[model samples]
Target: MDTLLSSIEMLARWDVMAALFIGSIGGVLVGAMPGVGAAVAIAIVLPVTFALEPIVGLTALLGIYGSSMFGGAIPAILVNTPGTPVNALTTYDGYPMTQRGEARRALSLAYSASFYGAVFSIVALMLLAPFLAKVAPMFGAREIFLAALLGIVLVIVTHRGQVLPAAILACLGIFLQTIGIESTAYTQRFTFGQPWLQSGVDLIVVVLGLFAISQALVLLMGRDKANDLPPVAKIGFFSQMKDLWLYRRVATVASSFGVICGMIPGVGEFMSQFMSYAYAQRSSKTPELFGKGNPEGIVASEAANNSVPAAAMIPLLALGIPGEELTAMMLAVFYVHNVIPGPQLFTQHMDFIYALYLCLFLLNVIVVAFLFFATRTLMKVMLIPNRFLGIMILTFSLIGVYTLRNSMTDVAIASAFGFFGFILKRLDLPTSPIILGIVLGKLMEDRLRTAMARVREPLDFIDRPIAFILFLMIVLAIAGQVWTVVKSRPNRKGTSHD
Candidate 1:
């Protein structure tokens, strides 16, 4: 109780409140505007936050991460376009509701369901805090290495359709992390004797290029499409709140699904959305109503979507492992602030964790209330042309990257990655694995190097309890993926012959 009170007192400052407010508004606008995702927004804003207090910076990012999905549902419903990538499933039913003149209803349900999911996930995580404190200390070097290895394997196998491509990109990201001289050996691995290459690649630089710049180019150069928003009925936002009770079970189940996927090392929102949306349909008596404006679908997708951001924090804070890209970016924040997450944090700085939880809780209230009154105003953001938004994003990159390193070389590196990102997007390749591979790759390398000295053989890598369990899971996941691929090959081959 004393700890909780102190956390609240710590947040009772002007800067913290301001960060929350500004981040909330920024998140809504980003979500209302198509193609401006939270990752790019975080990447652009990350440099600026380095100057602020650590708690304040994290609060701001949390605001954006927690609230954007609510805003994303707006474009999904009104324009049949997802403002954020996770919102793609929302359009399946949300847009249909709009076409039937129930836009306000769809928006309300999304907002409410999102609120429920975020709250539920945060509460669940809080309950797990004691458990995590007990468990985090058990991670030895071998266990940590095995966990990172499992993460790499999960990254490779989890992409249902692009397993090969994701594996290749994951390897590439792991390789990129090896550019500088190794830490213990002081050996140059990939520098090739170039003085400038000694620093290797910056994660922020890559993020700026791939998410910020490449996305800008895609918006700048790609043909713009017309978005005709359907007519909305005369309905107050509060009117739909009553309808949400009808789908409470669906929302609860979806939120559970979100927590499960978010806790997983490599799986994120899409997987949760897929699982929850499917479960909702399968359980519903009117399963056929799903793809045609069913309120249940919106609830399932948004509830699961919002739940993930908080739940994804579990592994990150507990074990020092980032499960996905957003957390990876935030991990950089922790490192930048000289605040390491994991066992030490779990045991010593429990108050920091509590403060973050409060921020997330308050963020939901602020964003939901803001969306209630400001959604129509926020949707106007989408009216700005992609070319203009793209230009602004580039301008942001120039300012942000310059602020980061004060070097034009970083900008050039970002440009290279931006082009690479555009090419990956054009090829429909996944980008998350690349980032994950980089983050976990370093962990695997350091831990593996340490474990190597203590080990007798390769089998000894999984000698410990946690290490053995993780290794088994990795093997099972890989086997399952292979079996799936082999099972589906004959069908594709038969289709080609036909």
Candidate 2:
């Protein structure tokens, strides 16, 4: 009760309110732009925060971090473009909903679920962060390898019918990740003697190409088709609220997974969203509804991704260890403010910690408020001509990719991948698994190699209970996929005969 009172008192300050408001708007704008994510937004604002009081500055930064997460969903749903890479899962069902004239419903569900999920995670961070942090270090190299392997397996399973093609793309992604210098040896592996390839491909460049640029190319090729806005029902905000309330189970489960994943070092929002969506699909009553405008899919993806930004702060605050890239940036902000995070943080800065929690909760409320009031204006974006919209997306993609490293080689890599992504799209192969491969492959390789170096035997990983459980989960996932395929064969044959 004292903590709650202190947080409420801290939040009542005018400067804090103004800071959060401005930061929220900036975050939404930055997040709505492709390739510019929370990391970029926060990094840009980090220097500015040094001039303000600690509560005010940290609250502003937190606002940007939390709001930008849901901001990414805006472009994702309307344009099949993810504003942030983590939002790639949103496109699977969100874009389909827009095509079916349910953009408002999709957006509502995404924002609402995102808010609720963040609430869950923030509460968990307040209550369980310390305990979770103590256990986090127990996740060794072998355990990390198993977790990443599970991520790869779950991503492959997301492609229901195109398993083989998805596997191939995943392998290609892994292969691409190996193009730069080897992490351990520092020697070049696949650079082909080119200086540009020495540093390897950037994930942001690949993500922009795979999602934003390739989507633009598809639009350009289909330029003759008019961008038509379908008629939408006059659904009230309360109606949308009711819909989201019905999916509370999904939001809860996904948020829980997000918190757990956030406690593990090196695991990003991608794995959390991927695993959540997979779990939702398997547990859903209408499993076929996924990837086809299912509200549950949006709920799972948005809730899981949004849940991550706050939950990620857990390891940072409790253990002085960054959970992912974005949190690493936040750690810098902490240092700038002369605030040291660790077990002593609660004792040394209890007020700031509780205020941080409250600030995060309010950030969600503010973003949702902006969305509600601006929905009609924002929805007009869907009516823009495809040619102009496509050109804008391509421009953003190129600029976003180029600005990352200021190298033409990066631009070329993105362009090449854009064309390749279009080709893969035409072939009906899933590109997401490729992304999963690139993102998780390097981590899995480093961890597996480290684990192997530590042990003399091949079966040593199973000696650790957590590693053993993760391996068992991987085997179960494979077995489940096989069973699903076998179960579908008879039904497929019956339909063919009929």
Off by over 4 Å in 1: 231-239, 491-498
Error of 1 at 266 (Å): 1.6
**True-structure lDDT of candidate 1:** 0.87
Stretch of 10 with least lDDT, candidate 1: 489-498
Candidate 2 lDDT over residue span 141-239, tens digit each? 787677777767766765678777877887887898898888777999888899888898866667667766777787677644333344444435556
After superposing candidate 2, which stretches have Cα over 4 Å from the reference?
1-114, 124-126, 224-360, 487-498
CA RMSD per model (angstroms): 2.1, 7.8
- Give each model's whole-structure lDDT: 0.87, 0.76
In candidate 2, how many Å is residue 372 off? 2.7
RMSD of 2: 7.8
